[model samples]
Target chain A: MRPTVHHVAEEAGVSLATVDRVLNRRPGVRAKTVTRVNEAIAKLGYVRDISAANLAKQRVYNLVFIIPEGPNSFMLGLESELGQAKLYSALERINLDILKVRAFDSDALANVLDGLDLTQISGVALVATESHRVQGALARLRQANIPVVTLVSDVSAAHRDHYVGIDNVAAGRTAASLMGRFVGHKPGKIALLAGSMLVRDHVERRIGFEQVISAEFPELDCLTVQEGRDDAMVTRSVLADFLGREPGIVGLYSIGAGNRGVIDVLTSKPEYGSIAVVAHELTEHSKRALREGVFDAVINQDAGHEVRSAIRLLKASIDETQVIAKQEIIRIEIYIRDNLP
Target chain B: MRPTVHHVAEEAGVSLATVDRVLNRRPGVRAKTVTRVNEAIAKLGYVRDISAANLAKQRVYNLVFIIPEGPNSFMLGLESELGQAKLYSALERINLDILKVRAFDSDALANVLDGLDLTQISGVALVATESHRVQGALARLRQANIPVVTLVSDVSAAHRDHYVGIDNVAAGRTAASLMGRFVGHKPGKIALLAGSMLVRDHVERRIGFEQVISAEFPELDCLTVQEGRDDAMVTRSVLADFLGREPGIVGLYSIGAGNRGVIDVLTSKPEYGSIAVVAHELTEHSKRALREGVFDAVINQDAGHEVRSAIRLLKASIDETQVIAKQEIIRIEIYIRDNLP
Candidate 1:
């Protein structure tokens, strides 16, 4: 039989109400008595059913996902997914709020972070910036005992509680490996496109891609990356001009959110389809391009998984419970036309 | 402010105890009083926090997963995942029980289903056999108002409440597509292997694979399927014999759980490494084979994901709550060595 609060009370030789105070972390219990109850708890190996206890106590979690305000398809998808998650978690008493800051603005993110009412909010999940100001804000939040989870683009220097996204470096390496294999023994030049090197996720992906291409496919020449700034028009014009100048480019890897632009350039020229093209995310546009044979493969991190994972991590952190690392892992997904969902 | 039980009682013109009786669906509540309470619930748009109410009432879910007992790595992996899930859900007041019968024994499965004590069990998740007896057993369980979820191999004819696994047909098509692409434009024959055609999952995968191969890659000829009955030794000998007899075979798609046998044959003959091999599941053996370059790709339905999804579906079914279809979906995951987690 499992141990209960009564068991702990009996073992500690304390009243049920006194045991409840210790169990709930409520004040007014003597320090020595608290120690006795804790020892009894350890002896009995009692585990409190956190969700049930929280529910009975009418504990509600107020969470916020601070995302970037943008027209980026990936961010839009993330917002849509977060909205759905909020609806799904209504009964769980999780009030999920989405806060948007100007895209890529470190100061704007820091300002938002500073303005947060920590007393009312249980936890925060954010797309973090690398700026020291953001890091300082994160440290303050931590000091205040509110947990912070970094989302897609991480600010590792901030010492966040958890990261709720795929490993961008691994994702990039996987893309490079796919590009190398799909191109099949051909010695040709490969081009890479990214949003910007300033963003950690894109930079990590670029680093991973270059490493694999150099180590595994020495025959393949990797050209310098072109920054698209995650803008569709910029990606299209820049890629089209590059393709015209480099006829020898046999493969292209787009490691950011300008796939629409990449797809436009590739679809306009039927010859470009013969070149191995790989991109990130599985938005409606990417899905269609893969189906139309404009893109060979896609590397994806499910937005739903990311949002849901963030919620779980934040709740566990708030409850001071152990997180199941393996269960919380957000997978790096690969999609081809045949496997697209 | 959110509507409370007091508000509900006031709206229904009922006493607090009467409201409790109606909410709990207890005996002795008049039908007219029940109707009044339900009308109040709808009128106020009051959504009951099921988890909270269940906690207050100390409701515990007794769930059983009827899995096939086998040496098959994938089934073993599923069992292991379920065990871990049971541990994880201990705090959720979920008592998850695993009932094992002889692998692929329809009568044994039917007998187990027949013997279920519905009074004690809240719900069941099972890997079902497509037999009249099994279907009849499932029908009786449903008639008893027990929620049933089909896992891994599905029993579609039984009209199970939910399916907590990948779409086998889609998984097969994905494998075929990867095989065709990885092997390049060479017009070579491909070999297909399976546990048994009697299993719905295997048969669906075969159908999906053949459909894609026939439609997209007319150059590649698909050879007849060989069943290994999910035995590693049987798979090894059969595949080794087939490889010897068919020199034109350039790719092999193993659609079932005997990948160790497939890997044994392939690794023994270094020359066979040229053939692109794709299979199912990501067991330790498959992971090593993929890393060692013996297997090119693996199509996976995460065992952990399946077990968790089954639990969620069963709990939701018991509560008569809406299931989030997207969140519950078990992804048809594709893994190459680069992306294997």
Candidate 2:
């Protein structure tokens, strides 16, 4: 028995239009409703015949991707992927509309969500939040038939259709394992540079990082986490202050953006023989630092894949296409100087 | 006046159907024709009116990404992106048909290219080679009006519409900078590992690495370049031999695939306390070694973005749409344990 749209709508306790929106990831649905519908779909295991379904529907699947706004290497990388995607847009059968949002603005995001054109977009892929209005708006959109896929961060209350990014906690664990291995059962002072606690991705990453550090690298004492907020200025100040004060710090882990500051602190003044440094995102700043021997390691998630994946899922919903689950998963990339592929 | 496909075809000296095929990235035609068409398009600066063209034509963009085969983590990551793209395909108003070819076989790829249904697809994206057949096939497609974008390693001879990925030379330079900085201005021996010299990306990376090392890292001596061909056994044996002979080797720069053997060799006896290591791609082998500290850094290019970008460009050709250049570029991602986002 094939699971029809009517069945999905009935299971989700929504109207037919609502099901259409949810499946297609259309705008104007509440987050809560979207989750309920997704939950229903997961339970039903509904799959569509993409080619036939799309041919019948005119195949207009418009999805939006909201990325954090910053000049940091990671954001820059994300921007590059998005630009490339636009150059060779993956979905000609559907429409992928992109909207870039400024980072750390909950109210602004809420206001934007309130005013988004519901008729045009099918779904959204965004770095998430824990705000009520955000959740409420998503719920409304869901009721209206729009689906949402969280990127980089999870929006738990909204319960979006899917998440198209890496597992930060696992990435953290991987980071810890690397730190343990490279440092080798030796005890030393390690400093951590975090971007911000405002974003869910950063917070989760920190949690996972701390967990791994506690379990594996206990011999190495960790310095207090510095809030860089992905700013070069703040990162420079924080790192400069730490390096000056804690000359004994032999290892460093910067979980935030803006490696230019770290590079400045490490290479500008006279330094010791060796200090193990690890950070995230392979931006120009970080990459240059790695080449210069200032940064030790970089852990990364490809922003381009996440963007493309989010759009594809939105289209599948709208087109009623069969999507293969095994291929959509995103993984973490770990970088070192020797193996820079 | 806006340049049209007609202008491009006339400039390229091909038939209207060939121009249409090239503009739409449709299959068929010979490789030489495709190149001539591309050159014509370049000469005429004929950009498609993607939105209107797509709305009018109802075109479907199908892109094929040929990556190295087997359980390579990076390749798997690319595969995952393809899967996810299928799920959210509705948003982009297109369809992506992805096929994975065996690794390191230019002839095998040429064979696969020969079997493609040119009329059905809008374009083709491949990690290419300078093979005669591959070029001929591409030329024919161009003549038929099918847009071909090279993924990862490019096909300059094929005159691909675009190369949707990072600059390997820059990546190598970046790697060298990191290696120099991490090792400090100390005299030490460094080992180099790679998959093959057949790849332009690898060659460029090696050149960049050597260029920087010789120019800047006078104290840090590079032993020699070893070709592993992305083979695990070969890398393990090579690394073991290198480690045994070069006891003073304090650094490793793997510019290729198959790092597991290297990891296994390094971790077997635990002589990895101060051996600074750098590699490319964040695979299971690299990830495990990174966690264990057998490796120090990784340099990565997002395969997902490249695949998606290629598909989008193809679709745009079919739809005759405008592609935003800023959105589709793939960037390098550097990872460290602390900032594993």
Question: DockQ scores for all the models shown?
Answer: 0.63, 0.10
Report the poorest 10 consecutive residues by lDDT, candidate 2 chain B.
B332-341
Best of the candidates, DockQ:
1
- Quote the TM-score that chain A achieves in each candidate: 0.95, 0.81
The residue ranges of model 1 lying beyond 4 angstroms of the native Cα positions read A24-36, B17-39
**i-RMS values of the candidates, in order?**
1.7, 7.5
Write one digit per residue (lDDT tens) for candidate 1, span A270-335: 788789998999999999998988888999998888998999999989888877677788889999
Instruction: For model 2 chain A, give the 10-residue run with minimal summed lDDT.
Output: A49-58
Q: What is the docking quality class of candidate 2?
A: incorrect
CA error at residue A164 for candidate 2, angstroms:
5.4
Fraction of native contacts, model 1: 0.63
Tens-digit lDDT track of model 1 for B125-179 = 9998878899999998899899999998888745698888888888988988888
Task: Provide the RMSD of all predictions against the true structure, rounded to 1 decimal.
Answer: 2.1, 9.7
